[model samples]
Target chain A: MTADVQTLASESGCHLFSGCGFPSPGLNVFEFKPIFSIGAFDFTKPMLLALISMLLVIGFFWSAFAKPKMVPRGAQNVGELGYLFVRDNISRETIGKKGDPYVPFLFSIFFFVWVMNVMAIIPFAQFPATSRIAFPASIVGIVWVTYLVLGIKNQGFVGYFKNMMFPPGLPKAIYFLLAPIELLQGLITRPFTMAVRLFANMFAGHMLIVTFSVGAWYLLGFHIGALYSATSFIVVVVLTAFELMIQALQAYIITLLAASYISTSLEAEH
Target chain B: MDGAAWSSVGYLLSGMLIYGGIGWLIDRWTGHSALFLPIGLVVGIALALVLVFVRHGRSS
Candidate 1:
């Protein structure tokens, strides 16, 4: 049987007093059966959701900006608001004047991530694609390449490593102890932590929602358990609302970090 | 700045991982269970703090 609580609930007809133990949701909930297979590839639910999110982002922008009025109305107006939000709050705040060129990149990342995260709250598509590590890892991979390339391009190859590993004004002797730390932090830890931060937040959020939802379902029955079920249901609702805010905040945070990384690459500090 | 603050965290964590890892290797090489691991961790944290101070502490 699928790990989905609703499916298990209907199939087993188990309730709090039914003598069967609670079918608590676990890590199994995150795993999905292949919707289809093509040679070596197995297309799953999260993959399908991520694909939809990308198309949604692309389609929205296309319609919004396809026929631009001198003064925007309808979708164009909303599109301008989204674009300006990223430009002003994220890109400009982080990268200044040079940030304008990168606004589209940050804008796309922000909205695509936001939509993927919001999928958690979306009925029937309750899983956030980002809760899966592969999605965030892929995004971080792009960011990793972008900053590394930009750093090398702006500072030259040797100069980039020099700036990253050997900050000026430090005593020569200390560099021996500190250079490796800097290298590790810059080259590996930064991107690793970025992906972990987004993935962990979504993963934990999804787990919490699933656990409470299953608890509620299992507790529902003709007994005192019904009241407990009501309480659990309330918690489920509250956590979902909290997840909504977290989804948007995570999107903003990742975008802001991306912009700052790009900015640091553009100009090396002494 | 938020970026500066967040990167400081990265610095601290990398410091621990790099040194802790080195310490672990030393332990395996020397046939001791936990001698250098703690020493490495302490040194790592100290260096990380110093790095944070140098980079973000004194903003002219």
Candidate 2:
């Protein structure tokens, strides 16, 4: 709906002084026409971007570490720095010595999400794949299953539930009231919030940029409105820079939370 | 610490959902308007706070 309005606005040279109203971006901005269809499924732009992000992550790391060098150089140096950043700052900080085994997982997750989010400002591919809830929800599903399985493996089936639902040192009489809350929090709320956090951040960031971009375009006239357009353009640039930082910060936060969840599963939380 | 903070949020949300839901059902069964919903929400928040303190705050 808004897409058609945007097209009409742009094609007809609609501006602040023009008879046509502002072409405001809305939820419709997130909707993309399918590029192709295979039977029941339709291939879309976000899906393609997500696929490219995954391949980019895999290809970069594969080439970087394909041939080990005692003295790191070029891509290897950059790759090692990225790898060590996740290892030391995120994984180890959250999961301790046992985190070494999961560094690869965390590294892949961090880079993949970062790349997907960075796509928002990358020229033609100006959309963050993580803005789509399905992407983040799927990642959260994997994390959810991993921690659940780890908890069962490490603490045994009953022990895992017991540890999760009944925190030690709580009053015995309150267990009945608190147990249900704990179970629901761990089982449902954690994954739901994790997915929503990433999706909402990217979604809001994209929305803000698009709003200002469209505003800048819509306000460009041969009058005082041009000044407002320039200001809107400036806001867009500032928002883009802010989003870059948020993208990295969100990636770090999600990965950190994943590591902590894994750590909690590996050993019952005290 | 970040993990703990996030967990506290989750606890509070789930507490509200669970208890507030129960309250809504009770209101339905008893035909009392707005009687239990607010009460349930308060109880839920209190319980969530207690749980948060026991799990995270006590460590310090």
Q: What's the i-RMS of each model?
A: 0.9, 0.7
Query: Which regions of candidate 2 fall more than 4 Å away from where they truly are?
Result: A1-12
Candidate 1 positional error at B8, Å: 2.1
Model 1: residues with Cα > 4 Å off, grouped in runs: A1-3
- Residue A227's C-alpha lDDT in candidate 1? 95
Model 1, range A1-270, lDDT digits (tens) per residue? 113677768867888878898887777789888999999899999999999999999999999999899989999999999999999999999899998988988998999999999998898888999999999999989989999999999999999999999988999999999999999988998888888889999999999988888889889888899999999999999999999999999899989889988988898764
Predicted candidate 2 versus true structure: per-residue lDDT over B1-60, tens digit per residue: 788888889999999988998888899899999899888988898998998998899888
For model 2, how does the per-residue alpha-carbon lDDT over A78-189 read when each residue is reduced to its tens digit? 9999999999999989899898999998888899999999999887788899999999999999999999999999999999999999999976999999898899998999
Span of 10 residues, lowest total lDDT, candidate 1 chain A: A1-10
> Which pairs of residues collide in candidate 2?
none
* Cα-based lDDT for every prediction: 0.90, 0.89
Reference-based TM-score, model 1: 0.96
**Model 1, CA-based lDDT:** 0.90
